[model samples]
Target: MAYGVENALAVCCFMTPEYQESKNCQKELLYADEQNVPIIPCRIRSDWKPSSWLVPELPTKQFAHLAISNKSKSGVLRKTFLIGNTHKELTRKTAHGNTSEWTFFVRPPSSDRDSIETYIKRIRVYLHKTFSPPLVILDRSPFEITRTGWGEFEIRVIIEFQDEWHHEDLEIFWNLTLRDNESYEEVDVEFDSYL
Candidate 1:
């Protein structure tokens, strides 16, 4: 188990009383932790809670709950969008000591690109007050806002849609960082066909 965990990209542990109490399971989880491997805790029994010792071993207290039952369901449509930021240090610095260029963007999945582009009318980004024009409006695809800054701050983004879509404006907040790194958040939008 240790060898497998070491080689695996991620380990999915089905949490249960039996699995938690096992000495071997404990060792495997510890080993995974030592090696910096990602552990995905899944709760198989609805009534069971992770043991005290097990709680600290997992990355976060939140786990995916899997309730097994006999039921029938139909397919549902889902769309995922990637919202994130990328930043890089610039050789040139501003008078206020700003030294990095950062860009925050919202990218829809390839399959839904056309539909998202057609429905989204514009994007509004609100930056920190220190910026000359704190609010920016983008009226095209590749919704993004790029600027140079020296510190990290929260940015508010609003996605406006065409009137025909009849959808409320989507508001999201992103943390803008001044570093040579990139991060993304996955936003899932589910739609009911009957609606």
Candidate 2:
């Protein structure tokens, strides 16, 4: 039934038992090669030699021996997820015809700020899963906090987002907090000047 609905230009494949333990995309790509369709291997595994010259080799390497194509050069798939502390969950969505399924979720709490970079990098590593659009959906913003001392420090931020994003309806605002050193008293201020 899957084959009946697939495009002639698309690559069809079967999961060989040998590949059951492997998360490598090469095996399925090899199958696509048999169908004369272009295959995009997520990454190359040192242990596995590319069995055949299935698709044209991409000039850049993504993961290990895996070559990423021109379409994937921008790393669009990996940018969908958000990483932060206090609020962090991953949600992925897949759609077919009129029926759409959403797998994205904020499963784990963002308690480890130190590990945020590692978490985000790992999310980017799974770009293969998001070949399609908007596979990941994050909550409003990631972890954000403002800590000010007696003096101010220089910072950089874009007042607006890139053109590709739908920012028309989005409202972005920030709040500042002041914590007393001696008493450890806390005060919330909408404007930085008040603190």
Candidate 3:
């Protein structure tokens, strides 16, 4: 929802029903979070207030994308999907009884070594969760590219749900690891979640 790099941010705070932190408000929150930029929270209960951080700036030339759809028609809140730089679109739908079937349009940027391992772990998680939805990339299975040297490349990431339970847990427990680029072996692992 933000348009420029000068005043851009992402709200990663938690909100209480007594104080609803709607999606619209988070965009502005993230903007101020950059560079200890001194942002006032929405004054909600349970918001993740940060004491400080080096400002994370959005790219000026290459803009980032955000695909966030908050409640379903029944008002059940779902997941939030964010990629630093990627293009996303909902591709196909099929009506069955009352619910709709789904396919997604995903084309992510080729990640550098800095984020490749992180991305791969996420990809593996999605695949296991959704059992590998009809991937947009037919020839190649979801894989990672390791950078042995100094260079950056973009890649695509796709996540599709098998049933109605999409990736919409307001807070999900997920596992993460840092690995060697070439070996793809886990160097470190941790489990954490956000709400």
Candidate 4:
């Protein structure tokens, strides 16, 4: 059944394990509620919860990326390398429909830093499985990968360096969310730091 925006909400009347895994069901549901109104996903045997970050009345799209900095010193070379961690988060809930994209990036402090790119490239190869596509690195300036999903979830990022002294890679598990900044006070405070 086609769900109208004015219908208040859409409740999955029936949910089968097969249906849950099918791409058709996801596409249909995405179309059914393009405006991103609170959708009551199938509860037949699922524990999925609607995203709390979205507020429909505001009618706005959100695009924000979170960045984490990792610093390490090479004991052998006695030099320190700075790695900037960031993500690409995009959420669109307009008349067009509700869509989102989440990607992660690891790079040196500046665009012209080629030496640091070498380390980033090696880390990308080492953590290929962590990425969705698992592509090899041809450039080292920035290593990045994008994930696919309609709902928000936590993603694990592992960055390995070429430091002989440090044998372990830096691992980070981030929960990616995109929503109206005004609705979340913590998000507001975090954004303030960038400014």
Report, for every candidate in turn, its global Cα lDDT versus the true structure. Answer: 0.76, 0.28, 0.29, 0.41
Which candidate, 1 or 4, would have the higher TM-score against the true structure?
1
Query: How well is each residue in 10-32 modelled by candidate 2, as lDDT tens digits?
Result: 54332222343355445555454
Best-fitting candidate, scored by lDDT: 1
Better of 1 and 3 by TM-score: 1
Q: Give candidate 4 misplaced runs (Cα > 4 Å).
A: 1-98, 111-114, 121-141, 163-166, 180-195
Give the clashing residue pairs of candidate 4, or none.
Answer: none
Q: Rank the candidates by lDDT, best first.
A: 1, 4, 3, 2
Candidate 1 lDDT over residue span 46-76, tens digit each = 6678788887777464688865432323323
> Once model 1 is optimally superposed onto the true structure by TM-score, how far is the C-alpha of residue 154 displaced, in angstroms?
0.4
TM-score of 1: 0.55
Estimate the TM-score of every prediction: 0.55, 0.21, 0.18, 0.33
Q: Best TM-score goes to which candidate? A: 1
Candidate 4's residue-wise lDDT over 1-195, tens digit each? 454444656434234444545666665556655655554443332323223322341234332222322332211232234322233334554353436554445543343444654443354332334444654342554465544434545545555555422335555554545442211111000111111
- Candidate with the larger TM-score of 1 and 2: 1
- In model 3, what is the error at residue 29, expressed in angstroms? 48
**What is the C-alpha local distance difference test score of candidate 2?**
0.28
Displacement of residue 2 (Cα, Å) in model 1 is 66
